[model samples]
Target: MSVKRLDWPDWLLSTLWLVVIAFIWWMAVRLLHIPEYILPSPEQIVERVSSSPTYFGAATAATLRVIAVGFMAGVAIAIPAGFAFARIQLLEKSLYPFVVFLQTMPLIAVTPVLIIWFGYGLVPTAILVGFSVLFPVLVNTVAAVKNISPRLYFVTSSMGANALQTFRYVDWPMALPYFLSSFRISLALATTTAVVGEFIAANAGLGYLALRGVRNKDPVQVISVVLIAALIGVLLNAASVLVETKVLRKYRD
Candidate 1:
């Protein structure tokens, strides 16, 4: 007789993989007699973080503030701007190049100017994060609107629907999915840009903590910060997916 196979939960599988990696890491360090300064084992990184939870907690909270503000502001601006660009050909022609130019400009390059203008604080950091988030959602929104079948517009017009009503009934619902599809990318960008911003200007953030780790030549400290940043990104991405599912259900219903 053949044996049956079991399917495992995704989280369990993921945890198992992490455990395997950590075991290999611990074994390698022990076998090779690696120095903590070069590449600390996972246990050392955990110990480092545990030794100073408050310090890392504060830095995480600070970075999160920038991310939350930036993500919200970026989404707030991108949706409206996307509609405007899609609805107005002249405006798109005139201003989109500028948007592209700004998008092309590296965050590191812009952070210094932002520091000069806003002077090393939350505002500049949030703005930088928002800038990073804007493009993907905006582009998706424009594509979503433009991709609508012309026949739907015809039907709405034939029913004597106003532009606003057509948009409410047709455009918003149809485009929302496309707009939200960008959320995952935008959130990831928000996290990364926040770190980069903190690296350049902020007094306290995970990036700042990592910078300190670099200064002190502490691998454990740096690895702990990196792990925390990665964990934050994963959580944010998962949250965005849940939100997208709930919102799409409401809109479609």
Candidate 2:
């Protein structure tokens, strides 16, 4: 099999786009002369983030740990359960509505109850992130599996392929792209969930820092934390996209 090469032109275009955005942001900061209290320039925000490495590092680490653990757990549970739902009509009929309901439930409302039950710590935070991100992955995976080509199934079965064989050779490969797409969405949700979880209760994390900023009426710090969190989310999403590209390269054509 021939390996596909990266499109340098695409990379160049993306870089140009980023440069344009940065230029616009710089222009806005310079032209508007926004007060540091109201809207710190990106340069000031970066300086703050750089100067407070000790605090920001600890907070980032704590938040990332929660996000990683919760995201993994969510994916672990969602994938197999999704497959079961897709494969079994009765399971689908029984569980689909509940999944939908869970998806619709507000995390803000649930967070307090979770803290009450689980106490304030990493456990509750992990659970919150997991719960927040689980539905999209579960539903998307199920849909991906269910939508597998009937012809592929027939061809596999005609060759006397066992269920496992069919799944390994056909179903998995077909669903991988969709699964990755779901995960891309889940990663961002997981990060947001982690932040929310910390907001509910925590002495550490970017979220906690954000809350502290708010309490202290430090808008610059507040905006800084938010920008950092947003950056992390964007980075995580970009990482997912990279992984998805690598995994789904064969299907790109």
Among these predictions, the greatest lDDT belongs to 1
lDDT of 1 at 27: 97
- The residue-level lDDT of candidate 2 at 114 comes to 78
Best by TM-score: 1
Tens-digit lDDT track for model 2 on 1-253?
Answer: 9999866775578668877977787788799886777777777777888999988889999999999999999999999999999999999999889988988988788888878888887888899888877898898889999899899999999999999999899989888888999998999999988997898856688889899988998877888888778878988988999999987886655
The TM-score obtained by model 1 is 0.93
**Residue 187, model 2, lDDT:** 93
Please, what is the TM-score per model? 0.93, 0.88
What are the per-residue Cα lDDT tens digits for candidate 1 across 115-192? 889898798999998998899989999999999999999999999999899999999999988977898999999998
Which 10-residue window of candidate 2 scores lowest in summed lDDT? 6-15
Q: Residue 137: error of model 2 in Å?
A: 0.9
